[model samples]
Target: MGIKIGCCGFPVSRKKYYGEFNVVELQNTFYDLPSIDWAENLRSEAPGDFEFTIKAWQVITHPASSPTWKKMRRKPRGDTSNYGFLKPSNENLEALRETVRVAEALKSKIIVLQTPPSLPYSRESVEWVREFFSKASDIAQGFILGWEPRGEWSKARELYDIIEEFGIVHIVDPFRATPHLGKGGVVYFRLHGIGGSEVNYRYKYTDDDLKRLHEIVSKYSVDREVYVLFNNVYMFDDAARFKRLINS
Candidate 1:
């Protein structure tokens, strides 16, 4: 298939996955920003040859309005509404920009905004996302913006259109197969596994499934760049599997 396949992170440390793939999705950004010094500490820990595609912190998208968020809120009793725990807003937009700046400083390839499962496929949310990306794109000039919708809403063309319209990429997690097939800038995937409520959504990629994936990649593998990320963190066993598939 002559494609670049990788995983979310280097199983335990960046040193382990180096030379395995050119890219790794540093997903910690999806949690919360630890500390400027600590973030830099992580950056220093990683090897120089690797490129990182980080996920946006959940705080910006899934703010602290709820009891759960209220506890995780960066600032206690801090106008949770501004950050968009319940929904996106100006404050949330600002937060997204700042995080993008941090990713930029780290020289990350892209920033992924994975919408929480609680988020429904609402027009308002879609519009809000569109507008936010319009603004985020400007700030993240060199880097791409990627979004992965969870659950059933993952397959909605309307949502896909929104992302495509903004020239943003899609993060295709195996847990939510949405049929995106990487139509956007760069097709991204996370191999969760093959069992659970969303088990059907999770693809184990057997030899047959690998053939289908290979065919899909072959069709678009030329010229355009693509990333296949394995989220099945059996200590980077999924990454090793991807390597064999592409090389074979």
Candidate 2:
């Protein structure tokens, strides 16, 4: 069993980050696609044993109205609704294709699809995602696709069924919800800090929290490769602490 601990994005210089952890989930790719040259350069610089997981471009899951779209180099034209929301539109399909190219350039084995909290649960929405993934399956071969559905969709059984059907890994914040979908192989945990009704990005994990997290990972690590990525403000420190706690 193996547990790879890291942060959602780099919190320190590349050299320091590589020295501290064995994995990283690239957050830049979620906001906008980077050039293949940039991805190649990063891959070339990283240690051979280091692993990179990338967030799929927002254009595949978020609509134009999403604030994250403001950072994108290109904006959607007419009928912006068709551009994202996993509608199986041509525009979204092309965006996913571009994401695959970037992932390949970085030699990333995991591609995370994080939907906005606004995308609520519905039978129609479930069907749309099913169709979207089905259409893109060819491009997704040899990659571990992880879907982090937020809002009401995060609570739906239909969403879980779709994940199982598509062979998608369920990405979750263990502090929020334990993943009930997907078969065993790899478990991806994104910690966003437990707080009121939603994630508290400002909250830092305590030693007690780290211990509990270690217990959770140990349970899963019996037969799966677990990736515990901290997404809070203190992600770098928290991940380092958890790594020490788990290894001890």
lDDT winner: 2
- Model 1, span 83-201: residue lDDT tens: 65224466676677767767866778778777666665677676766677777777778778777766645666576676657776766643346335334446666666667654343
Could you give candidate 2's per-residue lDDT for residues 1-248 as a string of tens digits? 78999999999998999999999999999886898999999999999999999999888898878888889886644467787778888888888888899999988889999888888567788788889889877778889889888888888778778788888899998888888647649999998898966588999999999988888888888889999999989999999988888767
CA lDDT, every prediction?
0.64, 0.87
Error of 1 at 32 (Å): 2.1
The weakest ten consecutive residues by lDDT in model 2 span 74-83
Best by TM-score: 2
Q: Please give the lDDT score for candidate 1.
A: 0.64
- For candidate 2, give the lDDT: 0.87
Alpha-carbon deviation at 63 in model 1, angstroms: 3.7
RMSD of each: 3.5, 1.4
